[model samples]
Target chain A: MDPYALKKLNQCRRERRAALLVTDLGDGRDRVVVEGDPVSGLLGEAVEKAFRSDKSATVEVDGRTFFLNVHLPPPRLVMIGAVHISQALAPMARMAGFDVHIIDPRTAFASPERFSGVRLDAEWPEEALARSPLDAYCALAALTHDPKIDDPALMAALEAGCFYVGALGSRKTHAKRVERLTAAGVPSSAIERVHAPIGLAIGAASPPEIAVAVLAEIIEALRSRGLEARKGEAA
Target chain B: MPEEVQSEPLDPLMTAEDWMKAGKDVAIATVVETWGSAPRPVGSHLVIDGEGHFEGSVSGGCVEGAVVAEATDVLSDGKPRMLEFGVADETAWEVGLSCGGRIKVYVERLG
Candidate 1:
């Protein structure tokens, strides 16, 4: 691999972007393909697959074998509340291979003892997000139920194109949320994506069960990522 | 992908660039392919300097010595090499992967 390619690949990784280091196994020539970088032909299709699946593999294209080394930013779960649900979510998401961060301005709830090894932020969502920022690879769950805490976060997640954005609320609560979001000019289409009454309808009544539902929903959003785009193309 | 804090010190590719920038002749060995129970996954990297000093792993400590030795040769010749290691041939290599898995490691000099 070329040194330049290595540097570029590493840069993408550090910045939490997807990149592929495609090396021609026959000639040792290599290049870095960042996400959304146009690649054509059979190799382009293979690279697209690699980006979606986050798998590295050797592909035979035009009688030449190329090793496509996929480097994807690890998926992250950011919770808007440090309540019982988030306490359950923090550890559960970690076990589910997500980097979990819980943000709550309530210092009592954000205590380290409750969070243990999880990243706990005793700050409001806008302030915390301004420092760290959200990206496409992140999943944001507004578990606070209070719009004061959850609305800014929901808007930010929608704006950032978070793979999953779910808010904890009943249908009645979500109706009001929709009105508020529309009043705030968060386009009706963007507001539509928030999975209100968050999580899979698994009849989850307990905090841990709710965590499982939310996690499953997040995983579904992650795995079924491109299917919606394909649907758009079909339309 | 569990977000293990990717501390730069733990990454072999970052180390390769640091080593190269420090004027040390370096070679990088990457696991190109692996079959059945291979300890390291494909795209795992090991960077070796000319002195046989190495960082990272191509196997579960079972095949590093051989890969490091070959990395020295690649560094000297400025050529790339593909090495296959497995329990398939104990006599063929100086050492074999005792884990009963096969792996192909691609070794090349880092520019």
Candidate 2:
């Protein structure tokens, strides 16, 4: 093991940052250990912190000091539509560490089989979003491709102060969306925050590819939000 | 990966300079800013010592040479300096930093 990995591990242990031990299998594969076998390698509270994903924790190992972010970033994905993109996106977002949730009045589209392992709400947009609640850390995306569904969700997300709000469509479609949202009592500034034509310009065409692009944009937004928060704290 | 055992704990929010000023000799390199998809966050700090020891990270193993070089200079001069690395820098992509993220590190010596 390189000293760097050891040093990182020590710091993470001290700070209670969740760390996985990477074991090379010599076959383009690696094994991960959360707390070692019998968890004996973890000294004191480091083991406990790893399990809990604590924020701001400290651990001592091998005469080194480790500081860790015990708090795991729990990002929420609020999807307004239960379309193909949503289906493709839900699983991928979960893999990327998002708590996926879907809202749509159409129960047929928002079903257990369609959105398995996701929080599905078969209710009107306003009702569903109010029940689930929203926070500054949440990422709200409208993909219904229908103004009726997407607009209401956008209103709910904006009112709840979501960190990232995006809608899928062309530039022309987005302009119309902006107009409708503005007329619906949503402030233009608040509506401006929505990332229309949502996602990086990867020129994606397929649903899966679009999901990839959109999720990438979401992560970037999340990172930027974190930087801003840090700056605010410093200020 | 082999885990290291810790002896002394330090504050995560404090940079290496802050730690050194408190009486512990420390060398720190910090990522002041970043652009694009950087693996590590800006304001990320890496602290080193006279024994060739260190903590934290600036890049995902990329641009480490430059950071080490700057850290060494800080240790010798007993002063602080800033460093930049990214896809924009000709030498950075060679070090495997291809994410197009730009990082500025402030290396400071504290004692």
Candidate 3:
């Protein structure tokens, strides 16, 4: 019921991260975790109380402990080809919880009608990616087999340090890609990070099957990124 | 409009952090060691709060039930437990960890 606690709770809620608002009640005898509406939730007698800043605050009702926090994560995923595989993969990625974007210069392919529920950017890769802004949490995949389109976009993805940079290609295509990347001055190790011939070996032969494989590989990379974060914490 | 629920699934590491911060007593079961063809890789985490609430996975639902029981014990007793599941063991197939690979899980009641 203190003025400071109420102000702090509102501030933290605006930030979308959760924190505890501890306060001293009138009796000054014991501390209780308050739940429900902040204004009406506190008991008149209890002196000390605490609750999470998020609307759903963590409060110990009776003997049970409550865990609550407002959830907000970074927005990340940009697909550099409006191909069929991308169509399948985009929805799957969205379901897995990513802010998905599909980019291609071809208006026919990158139209809203083609991707009804997805964000479609009808622009060339270089321009589109500049607006999307890839970061470590982001994952970039080039589903277009055309070298002119996918190659340059992949270059941008690598430069941005995207956690996962994948491209769909055959063994021969990847070989040519290696040569082109080397000639472009991209380090061999950086090129190695590209999941060329993208996706896990699910023997994927169709667009849908390939989409599953590609997403599986993306998940794998995401998991590895998580592992690195844990290791950093322990260290 | 129900503001589009942000779709990012719980990052396994963030979930682990949440477990520790709650002071609820928690255990982390990790696939520390793995052989070929494992469904989940080494470092895959299955975090369990003392109350049996959990996030993440160590294997495809195969060993989760058994691990949850073991984790429950670990949290109550505040000790560590090591578990192994693989095709070589009789119960491995029953638990789904026997999908042609072996994995060693270390369940530590983290501070």
Best candidate, TM-score-wise? Answer: 1
lDDT of each candidate versus the true structure: 0.89, 0.68, 0.68
- On residues A1-235, what C-alpha lDDT tens digit does candidate 2 reach at each position? 2234435544554343345433221211212234433455554346444534323333456765333323233678988888899999988998897878888788789777887667788787888766567776689999988888888888888887787999989999999998898888898889888998898899989999999999999999876764665576689
lDDT of 1 at B109: 85
- Candidate 3 residue runs with Cα over 4 Å from true position: A1-72, A229-235, B1-111
Chain B TM-score (model 1 vs. true structure)? 0.88
Per-residue lDDT over A96-208 for candidate 1, one digit per residue giving the tens place of the 0 to 100 score: 78888888998888788888877778898999899789999999999988889999999999999999999998999999999999999999999989998999999999999
DockQ of each: 0.40, 0.02, 0.02
Off by over 4 Å in 2: A1-73, A229-235, B1-111
Model 3 docking grade:
incorrect
Q: Candidate 2, residues B1-111: lDDT per residue as tens digits?
A: 111121233533244444444555566665655668877874366777665566677888787766776777777877667677777777754664777777766666543
Per candidate, native contacts kept equal: 0.50, 0.00, 0.00
Question: What DockQ class does candidate 1 belong to?
Answer: acceptable
Candidate 3 lDDT: 0.68
